[model samples]
Target: MDKKNIKKVVLAYSGGLDTSIIIPWLKENYNNCEVIAVAADVGQGSGELEGLEEKAKKTGASKLYIADLKKQFVEDYIWETLKADAVYENKYLLGTSFARPLIAKRLVEIAQAEGADAICHGCTGKGNDQVRFELSIKAFAPNMPIIAPWREWNIQSRDEEIDYAEAHNIPLKITRETNYSKDKNLWHLSHEGLDLEDPANEPQYNKPGFLELGVSPEQAPDKPTYVTIHFEKGVPVSLDGQKLCAVDLLSQLNKLGGENGVGLADIVENRLVGMKSRGVYETPGGTILYHAHNKLEEICLDKDTYHYKQGIGEKFAELVYDGKWFTPLREALSAFVDSTQGTVTGDVKLKLYKGNIIDAGVTSPYSLYDEEIATFSADDVYDQSDADGFINLFGLPLKVQALKKLKLGK
Candidate 1:
């Protein structure tokens, strides 16, 4: 907490009220040190980035760094999650959860370049993001000092933050009544706060400023929509025969899937810090990708490998959710995922309608589903008489237990 020796501090600035206030607060409290702001553009869009440099300057930052991380965000972080088939608690796509590490990494880079004595963030102490940011910083740059203003400052509530912004002449994106905590990027949009904190309360999508991305299922189109997703080596390559880039492919899929009301999940998941919080997320493209990828895995992977890979998927989700992104276990699990996906090249057709994903078709060159061997009809692919010995050996435990009971009774 010593600010006397600090000549400069680099802040992970979002241009939000909290981060806007931190720039001035650091200067005032940290012996008038220079504050450099870093706004990471991880596909939250150019709109949020617009006027960000000017805003940071106006808010007393000596310099501002706006790093465009959209393409890298999707290809490296989001697609990796897709490849692993990692879903937190069978629902969450880890949208905001995965974004923090990339942002923090850039924060450290800027901090080192700026020669700042410490790095700062606007995340509050209560939320999961604080953990995600700090843990990532520790993993990447262990010796760097992290200054969390919310954990240290006197501002205790969002109302106090707004008041501080007003007193300090800071421009903000939300007011007290209109604010709903939202995290947005190319992959998904997450809505929290307002009525969502209460588990008994149903969502009020009809209210203005309550929803994002697109319409809800009750407001979706009546007709069903079908699309084919082609994958090579576990990465989605095309949509409906059109070969698109990763970002464009996901964008097109989101538009189509959103129209059909493909994805909307409401869950109160357990956080790593021993608390359950409710969040409403809309991940249109991710839902579709998960289905197609899982379907390909079914036909491509063998019995034991497929079942065991399922366990690895769960562990991967946990590690990612817990912010253990730099660990060896995640890398080892990714290796297993990569090996299982060697034969996962195929296309899966899915029908989306009214918040449901239906499997329409699936085909793969390495599919183990031979109709001749699996059919019950008369065929020369296998002799039916050969099953007697196979069944006896397969059920040997049952046969031995039954014979033991018979001998005891006699």
Candidate 2:
């Protein structure tokens, strides 16, 4: 927390409102420390990254480093989350959750390389990103000092942040009326704050610019769109029939899923800081991928493994959401998840209609579904008489307990 010790600092900058102001704030408060801005290109699109270097320099940063993390983001973080089926609170897809650790790790690397005395982030004190960034930084550089401007600054609100930016002549792209906080990546786009803060307020999806990645279901086409996804050991390898790299595959799916209004979720989720927050997420490609992967698992994984994996998925979601990505438990859980995905290779066709994803077909080479055993009609593979014994043995404990209760009655 000592300002004198920080002669140089590496900042996780996005060229956003918070980070734009932090450049000058760091210089001012840290005795004119040099701020090296670091931006992670995790598929947030060119619009957010374009002209970022110029902006950072104009705002007082000595230099800007934009790391192209799209391939790693999709292949390493996004794919791993998909394989684990880890959805936070049965709603959130953990798009922003996992990206934080990756960005923070890069920040640590940049700090070490630059021989900086400290790491800085724009994440606010009340949100989850602070914990996520700090935890990942601590894991990589335990002794590195972290300066969170939001936690130390006098700015109380977004309005005040804008005032400070204007006072300092820092240009911003947002106005008071359009200042809804947002996070975007290849996996999803989340909209929060402003009108979304109230749980009762329905998302203004119909409003212009409210939904960036897609449209409202009401605005979707009447005709349904069918798409086929191919997976190899639980990783999506191709869309329809053409094989693609991880980034390209997900990009194509995002276009298809967004056009059909495939992934739109409005959720009130519990934050790691112990507060409920509402957010509307657009995860078009990710939603389709999850649906297809789960369908493939239905035929591939056994009942015991599939059911048990559901629990593991929930816990995994919690760990990812809580910023424990570098912890031993999360690594162990991911190992277990990987073991379950050995046979999760297949193709799943889905029909997307007005925000609903309907199953068209599913096929897997390692499918455990045996038609003869499952058939209700006459089947030699599974004898009907076997059910009589199974029922008797399965109900033995219940039957004995009932009999004992009957004997004790009067």
Candidate 3:
């Protein structure tokens, strides 16, 4: 916790507004200690990654550790969250929320590996990421110090940060003209700030600082686009019947979903920090995957399990939003999710048309939906007499209450 005694620091750097100047700030405040920046390559795209190594060093980092974690990210964090059907506030795919834990985990690992005294992150005091990063680091290295510049520094606003960067000659990838704070990854792209700060203002997606990954619904194709997604054990395995890796599969879906103007969400959500923030999110591939996966679960999962898992999904979303992914309860919940996903193997055909995903068909070998038993036409599998006893047993308490009311002669 003592800055003077700190000899080295590891920072979660994304070359964004908060982090671009953190390397220099850490070096200056922490007794001119060596600052090592670790950037997670959670598929934010090649442009963000291209010049990062040089950028970190130029900005005063002793070195930059670029952890190529796209596959591990999708396989580990994204898939598990998806399998649980976890979406924050019924809309947010939790793209940024889920990625924070993974990044923080890597930061701790690198900090310990480098024998650093403290781990640092660039999350603002107003944001949830401060809790997400700090909690994750504490979970692993309880005693290691955490340096949060946004909470401690004199540089308060974005303008102040820009002034600091310019004074220090930090080559920022962004400019003051670029007002919106953006977070992009393989899963989704999120836009905050700009005119979006006003909840009443309709988000102009075609405008700068809004649209990034996909086109607006109005700009999407006139005709419908069909996508056939294949899943094995609840995870998507292929697109249009061709087997692709997790990253590629999601990427492919992004293109398809984007072309159809799907996965654009404008939401004002409850922040883990207590304040509500409005954000526009582009989760193209993730939208298709969620819809397709839910369709698969409709047939694959039994009615009881299907309905019960919705509550679990809400809890899972809460846990993720609260940055409690490393907790025991999360692991146990994940185990429960895995148990319910055994029969969730299926192919879901979807029609993506103008921001709408219409179901085409769903098929699975493990489907619990028995067409013969469910059909309106009479089948030998069902007996009309069975419902008499079933309803009697089910309504016995209500019937008893009714008899008691009648006997009371009210």
Candidate 4:
């Protein structure tokens, strides 16, 4: 891909620090090419999107396209991951991990629609997002050329990028003191960099201007907050007694869960890029939903299926974390997950106290928990004499080995 031949380039713009400077960088490096900035709105809130068009144009973008992908993001990507019960490294809810592919897919669509010569992104070379975006791009448009400025440009650090931005006269909302790298969507808000880079430093959740979603557990209310989530075939369809849309349900949960300090995680996780990175995630709504869903599955699914699905959940997590959402294996695993969810319709009541989620009750029409047979008192369903034959057959090998050893004891 020659630079001179590239006439137009479509950029996955977020109006953040890296992307704010990338608009000008693209134009200068590509002979003043027509840079079309495309921002995907996956419920990062209006605050992030406010005045974005003006900012893009001011930074030398020929045009800006903001795609409203909130519904699709939750319904398609978030729900699928939720149904699969995927959790990366036993901690990360994959708020940022799964978002890249959806954003990148939209970028490819816009690039092809606009007849652009190349696609560009602001993902750093060392991070997992670069791989995620590039892999999705390759899956969609195999031959399309990609331009990653962080890898191509000579800027070595965020400080250098800031210097470049200042030199280019780009007005930024953040300075060095406040420039903690963050990624936020409807599901979660992640904080990394600055003091958070070191594993020893504890997260300043109680500090002002540190936490955006919820307070620390120490600040949570003394009384526990009870929440009832209704699931229909594995997907949450209602909160309390009211049925709501996916986005609305999640939004309401976020408000409730945030108020009670339900979801705050500090993890030093292994990145797909081969290094351990520390990040603090605030996922109030998602945490509540995951807990409720698991509780529902406990009663609905049989023991064998429930245990087997745990391994599937783990694999599903790895695949999503590694940015393999568009792959065949993930699709097959999702099919299996969906099959298991046929009986997952139920209502789960939870007690949220500080950072803990306690199960209050779980009820499902398809529940296999037979209280009559499982009762300690005498019951006609399970005969007491049946256990004698069952135990003998079950322990036949052990009994035979013991008898042989006794007979050979000269």
RMSD, each candidate, Å? 1.8, 0.8, 1.3, 1.6
lDDT of 3 by residue, 225-328 (tens): 99899999999999888999999998888888987889999999999989999999999999999999999999988888999999999999999999999999
**Each prediction's TM-score versus the true structure:** 0.95, 0.99, 0.97, 0.97
Task: For residue 330, give model 3's deviation from the true position in Å.
Answer: 0.3
lDDT of 2 by residue, 1-410 (tens): 77898999999999989999999999999999999999999999999999999999998999999999999989889999999999999999999999999999999999999999999999998999999999999999999999999989899999999999999999999999999899999889999999899989988888988888888899989999999999999999998899999999999999888888889999999999999999999999999999999999999999999999999999999999999999999999999999999999989999999999999999988999998888888877877788999999999999999999999992
Inter-residue clash pairs, candidate 2 = none
Per-residue lDDT of model 1, residues 1-410, tens digit only: 57788889999988877788999999988988899999888777677889999999998999899888878888888888888989889898898888888888888887887788999998888788889899999987899888998888888888888898899889998999866778888888888777788989988755655656656777778888899999998999999899999888988888877777777889899988888889888888888899899999899889998888777888888888888777799888888788788899999999988778999999999998899989988889898899999998999999899999999995
Top candidate on lDDT is 2
Alpha carbon lDDT of each predicted model: 0.86, 0.94, 0.90, 0.92
Better of 2 and 4 by lDDT: 2
lDDT of 2: 0.94
* Model 3 residue 367 lDDT score: 87
- Tally clashes: model 1: 0
Off by over 4 Å in 4: 400-410
Model 3 Cα displacement at 26 (Å)? Answer: 1.7
TM-score of 1: 0.95
Q: Write the per-residue lDDT of candidate 4 for residues 1-410, one digit (tens) a residue.
A: 79998999999999989999999899889999999999999988999999999999999998999999989999999999999889988888999988999999999999999999999999998899999999999999999999999989999988888898899998887899988999999999999999999999999989988888888888889999998999999999998899999999999998888888889999999999999999999999999999899888888888899999999999999998898989999999999999999889989999988888899999989988899989998788988888999999999999999999999993
**Which 10 successive residues of model 1 have the least lDDT summed?**
205-214
User: How do these models rank on TM-score, best leading?
Assistant: 2, 3, 4, 1
